[model samples]
Target: MSDTTSTTADRKLTEGTALPTQPCSVVWSDGRAFVLEPPVWVGLDHRGRLARLTPAALQRQGWSHDKLS
Candidate 1:
């Protein structure tokens, strides 16, 4: 028989540790989705939060406030 009890230290995942690369999928805009594969760097921003960047965010710094012709 093997020991089943595990501690927090044993379950912890090291930050920035290199693991087997795999393609990861994400959904956005209700049904729109995409996949990011290996060799792509994945890290958190200064704010330390993960969020999907919307189409409006790609145009300019503040497309929402910018006047459209």
Candidate 2:
């Protein structure tokens, strides 16, 4: 028998799931738009804009951010 417990890196986000990354929205939560770079963990409020975030905070949050060219 093998115990296949998934690691944080293996976790996927969906309904009822708490996403490690920020969610997308059409409106700005803080009524402002900001550019997000990799290595930053961001959270969005009711609006689409970035509500809160920490730079290079993904490591502590058990997540990794990658930038695609």
Candidate 3:
């Protein structure tokens, strides 16, 4: 999904080794708020910028990153 400029609550949610809840707060490397569902992945790109990516996209590109890092 293309990134949007909108937002979510500032309330931080608890995270675990596993995927947390659906509709959890996922932010960009710049701290830009990005709300996405679980089964998602997060990682830094070649530029070292934090990226919010879906597992499908990551797999398609053969890129590996922390599931929620």
Q: Note the Cα lDDT for every prediction shown.
A: 0.28, 0.31, 0.38
> What is candidate 1's local distance difference test score?
0.28
Which lDDT tens digits does candidate 3 get at residues 1-69? 221211111112212222224566544422333345566655566566766677445333332112223
| lDDT by residue for model 2 (1-69), tens | 111222233222122333343444211112223234433434554455554445333223322232111
1-69: candidate 1 lDDT, tens digit per residue: 111221122123322333333556321111122223443323233355543443233222111111122
Ranking by lDDT: 3, 2, 1
Tell me the spans in candidate 3 whose CA falls farther than 4 Å from its real position: 1-37, 63-69
Each prediction's TM-score versus the true structure: 0.21, 0.24, 0.34
lDDT head-to-head 2 vs 3, winner: 3
List ranges where model 2 is wrong by over 4 Å.
Answer: 1-7, 10-41, 45-51, 65-69
Ranking of predictions according to TM-score: 3, 2, 1
Clashing pairs in 2: 27-48, 28-49, 29-47, 29-49
TM-score top scorer:
3
Residue 47's lDDT within candidate 1 is 57
Candidate 1 positional error at 65, Å: 38
